[model samples]
Target: MRRALAVLEQVRDHAAAEGLSLTELADTLGLSKSTVLRLAQPLLDTGLLSRDRRHGHFRLGPGALALGQAYLAGIDLRTAAAEEAHRLMREAGGTVHLCVPDAPHIVYIDKVENETAVRMASRIGSRAPMYCTAVGKAMLAWLPEDVFAQVVDAGLPTVTTRTLTDPGLLRTELARIRNRGYSVDDRENEPEVRCVAAPIFDHNDVVVGALSVSGLTSRVTAARVRELGPAVAAAALRVSRTLGATR
Candidate 1:
């Protein structure tokens, strides 16, 4: 494991610095050029690694993009959860989102909004603060301890009157999310917007992202949140399992 990751990391880091040819890279890694060539072949096929203009020098390739798409398609946790999100939307008439924490912020990778044709402020590729939304909270609950510490070190920026800016309180909130298996955004990220999010775990039982449903604060009242929470959580759990998460 160490050797494989090490080689991938080294190739990525060194490619830009040394601009090595196959022979030079093999010499640098203390491997035969043929071995290096063979090792690089798979990534080359996947476009994660590529050869230089001469096909002798190596560089990261477009195949990496293919792998990214493949990873998303193969492990398509968000896509799987999207169905549940859409179902929730259909059942309750709102917008749903699938997001992953990118630290400092979260990015929506998929969504299913109502059919009303009204323009929404969020969708796939949109970014939101981790300290504000339900998806952010869901994603944050599973963040590595050291990363959480870093988030705590950086003062949380308040986006609205409902935003949780205190690190201590936010930490407490995260704890509750872990226990409850879901999160809520009560007009925190944006005034008048309420969101509910559930964590989606991967095969390793690690949170890879969150599934959320959002609507006008008036629409997702406290009572309505309670009503829809279980459905949303179940959907997220189902998607997690489809992604190979067992727990």
Candidate 2:
């Protein structure tokens, strides 16, 4: 079992870069070429790894991606937030999004649209800039300082006139978000859209994701936005509790 796991690990790294030759894999694992081939055969047959007949190189196959997708689909956060997102939409009269940080971006994993006249552009798999969305800012406000610095150093693009392009100013906003227990995007991502969001914590007290209520700025005005902030935060907290969060 240990040998099989080691072979998979070596192949996983090589598959992302230049695929490893059988002999190279043997050398990397300190095993004989025949032993490496023998260990890899089962993986190849199971579709976890694939070998090139033309170049004699080995890489990950479709089965690996299938397993990854399956794992992501089984994450508790998505299930925990599903009903809460619907509840938020019913109460707030806007679209509700459940998103997770993907480095400098936030990816929506679930959504519930208001049954009224409001409509939002986001879909289940849509992504948005982390610096310009309320869901992104909610998660970012809780990230460790070093990690937050890394994201800011990469670059913050201006999506609209209200977007915060300066790192110093963004930090100030994040601090306020941390204090308020939620974040707000005042037409930062789009000229006519606005959102309020709060972070969801995991059992480890780590911020695993965010939940946001979004709508057209005309309907979700400044006064209404303020009223929605605490509601969003409370809904997010409910999801955190369902995920076994203690913090």
Candidate 3:
């Protein structure tokens, strides 16, 4: 059983590296193509690999994604943000995101997609515009005024026509965000994409990350945006404090 599992790992690794095929696996593993298939049968049963996307190109399947996400979910954040993320998802029935600063952009560390009839692109690991995105602005609004200036000086390119391209306009918007303790995307990143985000603070009361709920613009109107803003912000603050973040 252990040996069989090892063979699957070899196939997965090789496939990831260079699209493993029957002939390749047979030659590399010194087994017959038939033998390779027989050995790979378990992974197929587990839905880890799929029939060649093209004629005979075996590749990863949905099960592989599940496994990867499971691994990610297993890691404990230095705080309780994940619990908040789960709660937000359950309560809102909309996609919830948890992100952390990753230099050039914020990295989506976690995402829970809404099970609604309508959906949006809210995937984990997605990187988005720092100036125009809700989570980005939420974090940005809490920074020192000098740091905010630095972000402006760093150049805020227009991602979408609706994105606030003028640094002065952005400054004003950020000010509003700071005042409200929340931020709005308003289709700034992608056309028809709307998001509401709130800043997360650690034990030091310092802003560390943010949380958000995003959906299509058609679904999230101005009033709905106003309604969700406080919820997302509250959730973020709750999680931030749970993470020992204070400000």
Most lDDT-accurate candidate: 2
C-alpha positional error of residue 230 in candidate 1 after TM-score superposition, expressed in Å: 1.5
lDDT (Cα, tens digit) per residue for candidate 3, span 1-247 = 6645655666677654656777876777787888778877877889887666576656676898788667546544533677787788777667888877654467787877767626666677888767888988888887777767766777888888898879888888989998998999988988977889998876557777788888887777899888898888788877765554444
How many pairs of residues in model 1 come into backbone collision?
6
Which candidate wins on TM-score?
2
Indicate the worst ten consecutive residues by lDDT in candidate 1: 1-10
lDDT of 1 by residue, 117-194 (tens): 344599689787887889888888987887687666766888898889988899999999889889999898888888
User: Which is the winner by TM-score between candidate 1 and candidate 3?
Assistant: 1
Off by over 4 Å in 1: 1-73, 117-119
Number of the candidate with higher TM-score, 2 or 3: 2
In the predicted model 2, the residue pairs found to clash are none
Give model 2 RMSD, 1 decimal: 12.3
Q: Which run of 10 residues does model 2 get worst, by summed lDDT?
A: 67-76
Judge candidate 1 against the unseen true structure and give its global Cα lDDT, from 0 to 1: 0.79
Alpha-carbon RMSD of each model: 11.6, 12.3, 16.3
lDDT (Cα, tens digit) per residue for candidate 2, span 9-121: 89887765878988888898999999888888888888888888898898997888787667545668888898888888889899989999887889999988877756787
